[model samples]
Structure formats: structure tokens, C-alpha cells
Target: MKATRQLHDLGQSLWLDNITRSLLDDGTLARYIAEDSITGLTSNPSIFDAAIGGGDAYDAGIHAKTLAGLSGEALFTELALEDLRRAADLFRPVFDATGQVDGWVSMEVSPLLAADSAGSIAAARHIHHQGRRDNLFVKIPGTPEGVPAIEEAIFLGIPINVTLLFSCAQYQAVAEAYLRGIERRLAAGLDPRVGSVASLFISRWDVAANPQLPDALRNQLGIAVGQQTYRAYRELLASKRWHKLAAAGARPQRLLWASTGVKDPSAPDTLYVSALAAPDTIDTIPEKTLHAFADHGQLHGVLADDGGDADAVLAQIAAAGVDLDALALKLQRDGAAAFVKSWQQLLQRIADKASALEKESQLP
Candidate 1:
């Protein structure tokens, strides 16, 4: 069997971390679903910026929308939703087969709202409603402020992909937020099948720490953190609190591994994919990493439920003078900032494309 199929059979979901109009129009996304066992996908401002701004694929569509008076985020929303809607439909079979456990395409709410609780909640609802697909997850960052938004969205029965988590503590915060929302639903006599996945970003730890670490410690922090978080995840699933919720028809909020692409040139291309393979968790893989793994990636072993050597590895890093707690928070903050920048750039590109297309329309 292909390595992708092996991972899927072992119960780890592999979601492509990209979306482009060309992929959809050219049957590339569909082929991924059929052959690669790619049950879902994820998108952010960065992904969309690359897709729309890097080409003429969206120019005509942007022009029509602009001519109809849509502009800025509203115009971008119309374009993004169409892509997400089509992708959602392509994965609908996996959705039904997994009983809504897999096959979810995530669309992030505006990065500008990352710090706004009310705005994040409102945008999540609006985007999820616009997509009109049960499998679509509105991604909200798990920032200090975004947790409340995640809870509220869950209470309203919106499936969520909690992004920007980088540590065990951050993962737990969002996991509990998801539980609180489910508990509130149980109290209010609402169905508690609201889906959620707390996404922990993997490679950025190494990226952020590389300049400060020795060769012995390079690229190991992210894997250790992932192991540490996975231990927390297992404990939560086995906890009495989760059991009670489970009996009451609540689903366990899954742990997801994000930013799984390798950044280190000397390392294996499938570094994160091979290291973080575990059942019941989701690994959203970049397209480059996904194809590399499918072709020649071999798994040495899957992660341990008890978080093997996580504490030891972390201790080693700390002995090297790293303050992990401080760095984790910084990484999350920086990630939010990066996404906000991308969001702004994407909107500007959309406006530029729309204007250029409009002027050209007048010439003919």
C-alpha cells in the first residue's frame, strides 16, 4: 500500500493544506481525493493569497464580481466560498462514510478578527452559513481572546478548526473551550455532536528555535512538543469528564498537527509526517510534503500515547537556555500577525486585479 493509505488505515487523517482554482478546475483536487486518500483540505489567507494573487485564474471572476459592485473582503469572500464549496462537495462521500468524522475543508475567519471575540464568532457563523456544507470547519485561532469565540461558535453547533496552538497548555485551553461549549449545549438540550479539532503548529517551533539551538537540539523541539501535546490529548479522551460527555452524545475534540512541512533543508522531506503519525489525530500536510510522503516516505514508528521522551527532550532544550513558555506565546502572536498581513495583501491583490480587469474591459 502507498504510505498515504498506510497512514489513513492506521487512523490518522491526511488533509492537504492547500487549495487553488487551477487544482479544482483541472481535476487535481479530485485526483487527490481518489488516489491519495486526501479526505480533506485547509486554507488560510496565505494559501488564498498564493492561489488568487499569483495568477490570472481568478482575474475574470474578480472582474465580474467587481462589476457587480462587490469589493474588498466581501468580494474575496464570494470567490473563496466558491472554491471551498466545490472542495466540500468533492469530499462529501468521505464525510458521509466517516459519519462526519473526516473529510472537512477549513476556511479561516478574517485574521483581522483574531483578537475580537464577538467579531470572530460572528464571522465564523457567517462563513459557515455561506458555505452551507456540514463538513466545512470555520478556523479560529486559539489566541487568548479567540478561545471565547471558539466556545461560542461550538455552542452554536459550528464545526471549528482551532488554529495557532503551539504547546500543551495552548492545546488544552482550546480543548477545554470546546468541551465547555459542548457542555453548554448539553445543558440547553442541544445536540452535542459539534465537531472540533485543536490544531497545534509543528514546524514553526524549530523554525523559531533554530538560530538559538546547537546541532544536537535542532529540529527536535517541535517533535517533543507534539509528543507532549499528544499525551494531553490521550488523557483528555480517557478522562471521566470526556466520558460523561461522550455518553451524552458529544464527540471528542480531536488534536491536529499543522505546519507539518519541513523547513530544514538537511532533514527528510516528510520529517513531520513520519514523526507525528498517530491514530485519531489529523495531520494537515502541505502539498509538497504530501506528495513526497506518498512517493517514498517510510515511517520508523508512530507516536507513543504516553508521549515518549517528550519531557526529556524538552528538558534538553531548556538546559540549552530556552524559555519554552515565553517562546510558545511569542510564536502564536507572530503567527497571528503573519496571517493578518497575508489577509491584507490578499485583499489588496484582489482590488488590484479587479481594477486592472475593469480597465481592460473598456478597451475592447
Candidate 2:
């Protein structure tokens, strides 16, 4: 069996970490969904930036929106929404088959609002409505301020994919926010099955810790953190509090592993995919990693529910003088900033493309 199918059979969801007009126009995304067990997809400012700026796939839509007097963020949103809506439609059947648990496509709110709770909530609602698809998730960062917005968006029935989490503590905060939202829904006589996922980034942890660790610990911190967080996830789902919420018709907000692609060229390409496998969890992998896994990646045994050897690995790193907590914070902050940078560059690239296209058209 293909490793992607093996992973899916082992109960880990495989979601494509990309979306683009070309992928949609060329049917590549659909093929992955049909053949590679890619039940879902996720997108962000960076992914969209690369997709739109890397080629002319988005030019016609950008030109039309430009003619309609839309530019900057507004123009970008319209273009992004077009791609996301199409991707969401492609996965709708999987979503329906799984009763809303599996197939989902995520579009992030502006990274500029990462720390703006009110603004994030407003933008989330706006984006969710604009997408108009039941399977769409608006991604919110898991920064301190973003926690409240996550809860508010969930309580308001806007499904969310909480992103940029880097450690167990960050994951807990996002989970608590999700629980609060579901609890509020129960109180307000709403269905408590509103969907959500707390996305803890994996590879960035190792990247952030690389320079601080010795040779033996290289490329190991991220999996250790993921193991610890997955342990927390299992414990949380089985707890009395979660059971109480479950009894009230609330679905457990799933733990997702984001940034699963290995960044270090020397490491195995499917390092994160093989190590972090667990039931009831989602791993959104970059397109290259997904293909690599399907081609030759091995499915190491699934992660231990009890966080097998996680503490020991973490303690070894700690003994080496790495502060996991501080590192998590730094990675989260840096990831948000990186997305903002990508967002600005994306806008500039789109504007330049629009201008060039106009000039070409005027060459009668």
C-alpha cells in the first residue's frame, strides 16, 4: 500500500498543506484527494503568496478584480476566496461522508491581526461568510490575544483552525478556548458540534532549537514536543470535563500537527509524518512531503498515546540547556512575523502583476 494510505489506515488524517489556482485548474489537488488519501487541505498567507506570485494562474481573476476597482487586501481576498471555494467544493463529499470530521480546507485571517483579538474575530466572521462553505475553516494564530478571538469565533459558530502553536502549553490554551466556545454553545442552546482544530507546528520547533542543541539532539525536539502534546491531547479527551462536554453533544476539538515538512535537508524528508502518527489527529503536509511519503516514506509505528519517551527526549534536550517554553514563544512570534512579511510581499507582487498585465493589454 502507498504510505499515504497506510497512514490514513493507521488513523492519522493526511491533509495537503497547499492550495493554488494552478492546482485547482490542473486537477492536481483533486488527483491527490482521489488517489493519495489526502482527505483535506489547508492554506495560509505564505502558501497563497507563493501560488499567486509564482505564476500567471491568478492573473485573469486579479485583472477582473482590478477592473472592478478592488486592489490591495480586498483584491487579494477575492482571489483567495475563489481558490478556497473551489478546493472546499472538491472536499465536500469527504466532509459529508465523515459527517464533518475529515475533509476541511483552511484559509487564514490576515496575519496582521495575529494579536488583535477583536480584529481577528471580525475578520474571521467576514472570511467565513465570504467563503460560504460548510467545510471551510478560518485559521487564527494561537497567540495570547488570539485565544479569546478563537473562543469568540467558535462560540459564534465560525469553525477555526488555531495555528502557530509551538508547544504543549500553547496547545492547551487553544484547547481551552475551544472548550469554552463549545461550553458557551451548550449554554446558549446551540449545537455544540461546531468544528475546530488546534494546530501545533512541529518542524519549526526543531528549527528553532537546532542552533541551541548538540549534534545528537538535532532534528529531535519537534517530535518530542509533538509527542508530549499528543499525550496531553489524549488525556484531555478522556478527562471528566471533556466527557461532560461530550455528553452535551460537543465534539472534541482535534489536535493537528502543522509544519510537518522536514526543513533540514540532511534529515529524512518524511521525518515528521512518520514519527507523529496518531489516531484522531490531523497532519497537514506540504505537497512535496505528501508525494515523498507516497513514493518511499515508511510509516514508523504510530506515536504512543502515553507520549512514549517524550519526557526523556525533552529532558535530554533540557540537560543540554535548551528552554523548551521560551523556544516555543519565540517560534510562535517568529512564525507570525514571517507570515506578515509574506503577506506584504504577496500584495506587492499581485499589484505588480496587475500593472504588467494592463500594460500588455494596452499594446494594440
Point out where model 1 deviates above 4 Å: none
Write model 1 residue lDDT over 1-364, tens digit each, in one string: 8999999999999999999999999999999988989999999999999999777999888998998999999899889989999999999999999989999999999999999999999999899888889999999999999999999999999999999999999999999899999999999999999989999999999999988999989999999999999999999999999999999988889899999999999988999999999999999999999899999988878899999999999999999988999999999999999999999999999988888888898995
* Candidate 1: C-alpha lDDT: 0.94
Clashing pairs for predicted structure model 1, backbone only:
none
- Model 2, 1-364: lDDT tens digits are 8989888888889999988888998889989988999999999988988898788888999888988999999999889989889988999999999889989999889999998999999999999989899999999999999999999999999999999999999999999999999899899999999999989899987887898888899999999999999999999998999999998878879999999999999899999998988889999999899989999999768888899999999999999989877888899999999999999999999999899988987898
- Candidate 1, poorest ten consecutive residues by summed lDDT: 355-364
- Per-residue lDDT, model 2, residue 279, is 89
Deviation in Å, model 1, residue 211 alpha carbon: 1.7
Measured by lDDT, the strongest candidate is 1
Off by over 4 Å in 2: none
